[model samples]
Target: MKVKEVTFSYNQTVEQLKAVSLAVEEGKITTIIGPNGCGKSTLLELMSGHYTPKKGQILLDGKAIQQHSPKELAKRLAVVHQKNDVPFDINVERLVAYGRMPYKRFLHSPSEEDEKWIDWALSITNLQTKRKKKVEELSGGERQRVWIAMALAQKTPILFLDEPTTYLDLYYQFELLELIKKLNREYNMTIVMVLHDMNQAVRYSDWMIVMKNGQVIARGVPEDVITGERIEEIYGVKAIVDYREDSGVYVVPIGPCQRDE
Candidate 1:
């Protein structure tokens, strides 16, 4: 997907994204990282067609995103937002089956092929055993996986996640990230996500877009864009950007800096 000079605002007076433009590399994991309210999630929403740009265009496969019908867009891209509201008594399997809605005709049940995809999504998310459990009964991380499973069941070429690791403990955060990486590597899915953890972003992303004040300050390979100076500039923190032969590049923030108000 490609965004060209896009601008967006929530309330007409306050712009959220300002003339931002970037291309999501096909078949690779591209992450958007920046400080709070820097338009990372807003950008993802714009690309996924949840929000229309006020001044630019988002293209999928060279066609304007707005040109596609809702069902057609659902078939091409799946999105997992930061939070999901699950209905009471909905089991994991049933919830995931909802992803097949785009493929179903009105009043028709899931076909055998739809069942196959649902099962595969459950297995990959390690939610097969919990298939019968109510989504509300699961822990935070498990619920997150259930949502991911639903997205996976959609069987789209591109997946967009917004702060997917939010509210999870360290262990589950890493676990979910690993599962996402597996999807990208094994399925060749084009993945775009917003992440706040700089280290995790650098560790997993093939490409990074760093934004500040609603505009992209830098976009490139993680190794080249994630540096102490850039971190200080974007996040207003002192950080150490280190590279080890075995572990690659990582960031360690020391402390916050005083910023002019």
Candidate 2:
């Protein structure tokens, strides 16, 4: 996926994103990070075709995104937001089945192929036990997984997740991110996500974009892009990064900084 010279604004004249541009490589994870009120989410929305770009274009495999029909786009891309509100009456299995809608025609029911995908999605998200359970009955982490399962059922090659780990507890956070890593490695699903947890973003992403006030301040491998100076510049605080010869990549927040004083 590519966002080329994209610009966007709110209901009025204030600009949300400037002439921003970035490319997400196929079959890898790219994480975006920035201070609050920056245009990180807006960029994702544009790349996902949820919003139109006033200045430029988004492309999938060199084809313009809007050039494709809704179904065509849905077959290639899926989005999972930070929060999803589901009807209390809808069961988890039914929720995940919705991902197959793009592949269905009016008056047509799911085929055996659709069932296969839905079943696989539920199993991957570990919602098989709760397949019959209402989304409202689950914990925050479980509900988030349900949303992910829905996206997985879409069977898209790319996924967009906006701060997916925000409210999840420690176990669920690791569990969910690990699941995402496995998907990238196993299925080769390209991923783009916004994350506030720099450590997790660095640990999980192959490349990262650090934004400050709606512009790409820096971007590269985590080791090069997430330095103490860059952290202080973008996040407005100091950070420490150290090399563990065993790990190779720089590990961040390994020590306390003077900013904590």
Candidate 3:
């Protein structure tokens, strides 16, 4: 997917994204990282066809994203938003079956093919045992996996996740990231995600798009895009961009920048 000089705004006065452009490398994990309110999530939404840009275009497979029918788009891509809500109590398998809706006719029951995909999603997410369990009964990490299972049941080539690690504790955070990495490595899925943790972004992303104040400031591999000066510039924090033979590239933020600096 490619975003060509896109711009978006929630209201007439303030733009959320300003003349931004970037290409999501196919069959790789591309991460968007920046400080809070930097339009990371907004850009993801636009790429996933949830919102339209005021200017420029989002192209998928050489065609405009908006031109695709809703069901067609859903078949090509799946999205797991920052927060997923279920108003009523639902079991894992029932909820995951929703991903196959694109292939179903109005008021039609899930076909045998739909059941196959639903079971596949549950198995991949390690929720086979929880198939009959209520979503509310699971832990935060398990619940997140249920949402991902729903997306996986879509059987799309592309997946978009928005700050997926936000509310999870440290253990669950890494667990989910590992699962994401596994999906990319084993399945060759084209994954695009918005992440706030700089180190995690570096660890998981094959490519990074660094944004600031609603614009992309840099785009490249983690080692190339994230630097000490770049961190201080974008985040207003003094950080040490370091490398270790074992861990690859990582960042150590020492302190905040003073106003005068």
lDDT of each: 0.94, 0.88, 0.94
In model 3, which runs have C-alpha deviations exceeding 4 angstroms? none
Backbone collision count in every prediction?
Answer: 0, 0, 0
User: Per-residue alpha-carbon lDDT of model 2 for 128-225, expressed as tens digits?
Assistant: 99999988889988999999999999999999999999898989999999999989999999999999888788789999998877788788999888
- Over all chains combined, what TM-score does candidate 1 have? 0.98
For model 1, the local distance difference test gives 0.94
lDDT tens readout by residue for model 1, 135-242: 999999999999999999998999999999999999999999999999999999999999999889988899999999999999999999998899889988999999
What lDDT score goes with residue 73 in model 3?
99
Show pairs that collide, candidate 2: none
Q: How far out, in Å, is residue 142 in model 2? A: 1.0
> What TM-score does structure 3 among the candidates reach?
0.98
Rank all candidate structures by their lDDT, best first, as comma-separated numbers: 1, 3, 2
